[model samples]
Target: MYTLLIADDERAIREGISRSVSWSDIGIGRVLLAANGKEAYDIIMKERPDIVLTDIIMPVYTGIELVEKVKDTMPQVQFIILSGYNDFAYAQKAIQNEVKQYLLKPCDAESIRKSVQKAVSRIRDIEKKEQFIASMKENVEKLFPQAKEQFFRDLVHGSPNTQNIEAYKELFNVHDGPYRMLLFRIDDNDYVKLLTLKSLVERNFGEENVTFCIIINTAVVLLTTLTGFHELSGLVEKTQKQCYANFNIEATVAVSSEGCISNAAQMYKEIRDIIRFEFYLGEGRIITKDDISVFRNDYSLDTGIQTEELSAAIRTGNIDSVKSITNCVFNAYRMKGYDINRIRACGIELFIIVLKHCEDCEINAWIKNITRINECNTASEIKQFILDFAVKLAERTYQSVISSQNRVIEKVIRYVHENLDDENLSLQHIASDILYLNVDYLGKLFKKETGMRFSQYLLKVRMEKAKELIKASSGDIKVYEIANATGFSNNPSYFTQVFKKYTGCVPKEFRETGKQEEKDSGWLPL
Candidate 1:
C-alpha cells in the first residue's frame, strides 16, 4: 500500500484533488491534504508518504523550496508539481528537483491517476531492490563462519593453493607474520560450554587475531601475529583457567611449533598428533611440542609378553591376574620414562588385543568401550580403565565357557540316548573319540551337572529303557532282545542282574508281574 499527499493554497483545489482523485484505485491507501507548502512539508516530514502533489506557487514557501529541502533526506519520496501557468522557469526548477510529473491546473482524473500509478510502480521497484540486498546480506552473514572454518581446514590439510593464499588472507583479514595453532581437547560436549570457551578466547585475543572452530570435539585455535610461545602459552593458560572457573570444564591445550603461515598446515597436524599423548600428560595442562621432544628417545616398549600374559589371564577369567599384568605394563612405562606417544601406542595395541579376545569369546559389549581409550589422561587412569574393561570381558568370557560346556554336556546326553544299543558309548568314546574334548574335564563337568558319575548315569538310562521295552512288549518280546536293545551287549544274564538290582526282581519275573507291581510301587510309565 502507498500514501499520497496533495498540497495547494486554494481550499477548493486541495479538497477537490483529495475527493476527485481515485487514489485507492491507483494503489494509494490514504490521501493527505494540506492548504500550503509549509503544512505539506510538515506532513511530509511526519508521514513520509510515497507520493506528493504540490502547487508551484504557494504561501509561506513555494513547492520548489519544499522539494529542495526534503529531497536529500527522503530520496525515495516521489513528487508531482501542479501549476496554473506554463512557465518554462517553473518547469526547469521542477526538473532540477527530480519531480516525477508536472501538470497544469485543469488536469483530469485520468491524468492524476496515471501519475500516481507510475509513482507506485517506481516505489515497488525500489522496495524490491532493497529487500534483495537485505536477503543477500543475511545469507552472507550465515555462511561466513563456515567459509572461514573451511579456509583454515584447507590450510592445515595442505590442500589450499598458495597463489590464492593472499587473497583469502585479505578476505578473512588475517594479519601477516608468526602464527601458531593451538589444539585444545575438551572433554565435555555441552554446546553452551563450547560456545562460552570460544567467546572467552576471542575476547582475550582480539577477534581478528584468533580464529577458532570445533573439529571432532576438539577446539582448534589459529593465533595470528603471536609474539612468541611465551605469550601464546600465557593466553592459553588464562583461557583455560577462565573456562574452568566459569563453565566447570576441564581442557588440555597442545601448542604446535610456531612458524609462518606457509607451515600452518604442518603445525596443525603436529599439534593434533601431540595432543593424543594426553594419556600420559594428564588433562588441565598445556603441552607443547618442545615439552615432549625431550622425552622422545628411541626406547622400545616390549609389551609383547605383558600383552600375552594379559590375554592368557583374560581367557582363564582371572581378574586378579589381568589387573596385575595391566599394572606392570603401565608401571614399566612410568618407571622407564617412555615416550608418551609410544606409551599411548602400546595402550592402543593392548586395547586391540582385548577387543579381539572379546570377539573370540562372543562378547560384543566391549566394542563400544573402545572409544574410552582416548579419554584417559594418565597412565593410572588408563590402567584403571583397562582393568575395569578386562574384568567385564573376563566375566562374559567365563559365562560363555560355562554355556559352551553345558551345550557339550547336552550333546553327550543326546548321543548316549541315541546310541545306547552300540555297546561303545563310554565316557572315553564320547569325550576323546567323538566330541574331542578333554576326557577329565568332560567327566567332571558331566558328573557335576548330572549329580552322578558317567557310568552310573549310563546304567540308570539303560535300565530305564529296559523297563520301558519290557512294558511296551507285554511279554511278547524275549528277554535277550530287551537286553540287546538296552545296551546290555545281548547278555541276558548280566541284564537280569542289573535289572534285579534296579527293580528288585529278575527280568522274567518283572515282565510277568510288572504291570501289577507298577500300581503298588507308584512307578509311572516312562
Candidate 2:
C-alpha cells in the first residue's frame, strides 16, 4: 500500500483526515498529518510519501507554495488540492500544479477516496513502466557491454548515449572494473533537483576519461560506479565535496570491488550492506571504502541448478544422455547448495558457447535470446533453462544427423543415374564416385545408407532406364540396338530376359504399359 501525507491549517480537518474512512482502503497503509504547509514540507523532506493532500491556504507556507516546492523537488508525489474559496484564481493555481482533483472545503470522504484511488492507479502504472525499462536495460547491458560502455561514455561527457535502448532506459553502464555501491538519502527528487544535479555534474567535471550514470530525483538509489575500487577512494572525496557544496544533504557511498558488473544482481547486496550500516555514517557524510570495508559480505546467494553441461551436450547432439546428466547435476547442486555465482557463470558459458556455435556453423538465430540469458544473475535457474532448451536442441541434432547419414544411399543412387551409360559403372565405380570404401565395404555401406543391396539396386536402375528408353523411342528399334544402347552390348534377347526378371514383363511389354500410363497422365508426345 502507498503512504499518504495530509496537510491542512485547520487542526480539525487534519485530525479528521487521519481517522476518517480508513486511508488504507484507498491503497494508503501509512498516513501522516501536518497542521500547516511548513510542517507538511518538513514531513515530506523526511518521509517522502507517495501522495500529499493540502489546502490552498495554510500558515507559514501556502499549500500552493508547498505544492510548487514538492513538484520542483519530488515530481512523483501525487497531490489533491483543497480550497474553501470558489475563486477562479485558486482553481488556476490548482491546475498549474497538475493536481489530480480539487476538493472543496469539507468535501465528503467518498470524493477524497476516489481521487486518491485514481492517483494510486496512475502511480502504480508509472512504477511498472519504470520497472520494465529497468529490466530491459539490465538485459541489454549484460548482452551488449560495448553498448553499455558507450552509454557511460556519453553520460560522463554530458552527451546522450544516442538515445537508443540503453539510453532511453535511463540506465548507467559500468566498464570492466571493480566497483563499489552506495545508497544515500535525499530531500526530494523533483524535476528541478534532478535536472540541476544533472546539469551541475555535466558542467563541473565533464571528464572524458571517467564514465558515470547520474539519475537524480530518486530518493532510494543513486547508482554510480568507479573505474576501480581505488578510484572509489577518490570518488568518496569528490562526492563529499560536491554534496557539501551543491545539495548540502548527507549522502552515503557504498563502494563495490572490481569484478564483472554482469553479476550486478550480486552487487545489490553490497549496496544493501551500506544501507544497513547507514547509521554508522551519523549525519550526511561521505563514507569511504576504508569505513565500509569491514562490513562487506563474502556470502553468495543461491543460484539454481546449473545445466551448462547439458547445453553443451545438446549442442553436440547428445540428446537423452545429456538430459540425464542435467538431472543428476541438478540433484547434486540442490542437495549441496553450491555457490550461485559460479553456477550462473556456467549458465552464461552455455549461452556463449551456443552463440559461438551458431556463428561458427553460420546458422540463423534470434539474437535477443543471448541478451536475455546474459542479463540473468541467478545461475542455477539459467542452467536449468539451458538444460531444458538443450533437450529439444539435442533431439533436433539427432534427427538431422540421422537424415544426413541416411542420404548416402540417395547419393549412390544419384551417382548411378549420372554414370549409368558407362559399362564400368559397377558397384566399385559407384562407391568410388560417392567416396565410399572398398567394393566389398561399399556394398555394406550402400545397404546401410539405403535399404537395398548393391546388385538389386543396380538391376532396378537398369530396368527403369530400359523402360524409359523404349517408351521414348518412336521407331521400332531392333532388340540388339536397345541392349547396346542401355549398358548391354550385342545381345538384345539377353537384355530382354534381365528386364523381364526385374519387372515380371519383357522390355516391349514394359514399354507398352509405360506409354499407356504416360498417355493417361496427359503426356503430350512428340
Candidate 3:
C-alpha cells in the first residue's frame, strides 16, 4: 500500500479531491491533506509519502520551491503538479522538478485518479527493484564466509591462482604490504566462541586490516600490512584478554614470520606448525617462531621403561599403579626442565601405547580420548589425560577379560552337554584331547565356574541322564541298560546307589512310582 499527499490552498478543492478520488482504487491506502506547500513539505519530510500532489502556487511556500528542496533526499517519491495557470513557464518548471503528472485547476476526479494510477505504477516498479537489490545483498552475505574460508584454504595449500593474487587483494579490500598470519587453536573447540573472538579481533584491529577464516578446527587471522611484530603481538594479547573476559575460553595463538601477500601460503604453513606445537606450549599464551627458536636444542628422552610399566599396569587393571607411573614420568620431565617438544613426544608415545592396547583388546572408540590427549597443554593436563586414559583402558580390559571367561565357560558347558553319553568323557579327555587346555587348570576353572569338583559334576550329569532314561523307558529297558547308556559303565548296582543318593530313590522304585513326589518329600529308602 502507498500513501498520497494532496496540497492546495483551497480547503474545498483539497477535501473534494481527497474524498472523490477513491484513493484505494488507485492503489493508495492513505490520503493525507496538506493546506499549503509548507505543510506538505513538513508531511513529506516526516512520512516520506510515495506520491505528492501540490498546486504550483501556494501561500507559505510555492510548489516548485517544495519540489526543489526535497527532490534530492526524496528521489523515490513521485510528484504531480496542480496549477491554476496553464502557462508555459509553470509547465517548464514542473518538467524541471521531474513531476510525474500535471493537472489544470478545474480538473475532475477522473483526471486525478488517472494521475494517481500512474504514480502507483511507478512506485511499484521502484519497490520491485529495491527488493531485487536486497535479495542480492542477502545472498552475498550468506556466501561470504564460505568464500573466505575457501580462499584461505587455497592460499594456505599454495593452490590459489597466481594470476589472480592482485585481483583477490583488490576484491577483498586487503592492503598490499607485509602480512602475518596468526593461527589460533582453541582448547574448547567451540566455533561460536571462535567466531566471537574473530569479531573482537576485527574490532580491535581495523576490519580492513584483518580477515578471519576457520580452516578445519583452527581459526586463522590474516593481519594485513601489520607494522611490526610488537604491534601484532599486542593485538593478539588484547584479543586473548578480551576473549577470556567475554567468553571464558582459553586460546593459544601462534604468529607466523613476516611476509607479503604473495607469501601468505608459506607464512600460513610456518604459523600452522607453531600452532600444532601448542600441544606442548600449553593454552592461553601467544607463541611465535622466534619464541621457539631459543628452545632448539637436541633434547630427547628415553620413555621405553615408562611405556612398558604403564602398559603392564593397564593390562593388569591396576589403576593406582598406572597413575603412579604416569605422575612419575611427567614429574621427572618437569624436574629435568625438558622442552615442550620433548614432553609432547613423551606424551604422544604414552598415548600411542594406550591406543595400541585398546586396539589389541578390540576397543576402537577411543577417538574422543585421543582428542583430549592432543589438546593437553600443560604437565598437569598431560598427567590427567594419561590417568583418565589408563582408567578407561583398565575398565575396558576388565570387561574384555570377563567376556572371554564367559565365552570359554559357555564352550566348556556345551561340550559337556554334547558328550553326556560318552564313557571316556572325563575332564582329562575334554581338556587335553578336545579343548586343547591343561587338565589341572581346566579342572580348577570349571570348579570355580560351576562351584563343584569335576568328578562331582560328571557324576551328577550321569545320574540325571540315568533317571531320564529309566523313566522314559517304562520298564522296557532294564537297570543295566540304563547304567551303560548314562556313561556309568556296566554297574547297575552302582547306578542305583548313585541315583538313590542324588534323588533319594532307588532306580526301580522311581520308575514304578511314575512320579518323583517322594523326591521332594526327602524320602530315602535303603
TM-score of each: 0.52, 0.33, 0.45
Clashes of each: 0, 14, 0
Assess each prediction's global lDDT (C-alpha) against the native: 0.78, 0.63, 0.76
Winner of 1 and 3 under TM-score: 1
Instruction: Give candidates' CA RMSD values in order.
Output: 21.6, 26.3, 20.7
* Residue pairs with backbone overlap in model 3: none
Tens digits of per-residue lDDT for model 1, 62-141: 99998998899998899999899899999999998899799997898788778888989999998999999999999999
> Please, what are the lDDT tens digits per residue for candidate 3 over residues 341-457?
667666765676676566523444564555665566776887787778788888777778777767776787787778776777888887888889898988888878888877777
Location of the lowest summed lDDT over 10 successive residues in candidate 3 = 517-526
User: RMSD of candidate 1 to the true fold?
Assistant: 21.6
Q: What is the lDDT of residue 480 in candidate 2?
A: 71
Q: Which should have the higher lDDT, number 1 or number 3?
A: 1
Best candidate, lDDT: 1
Best by TM-score: 1
Which runs in model 3 stand beyond 4 Å of their true positions?
9-12, 34-49, 57-60, 135-149, 159-163, 166-171, 184-213, 217-255, 272-526
**C-alpha positional error of residue 92 in candidate 3 after TM-score superposition, expressed in Å:** 2.2
* Best-to-worst lDDT order: 1, 3, 2
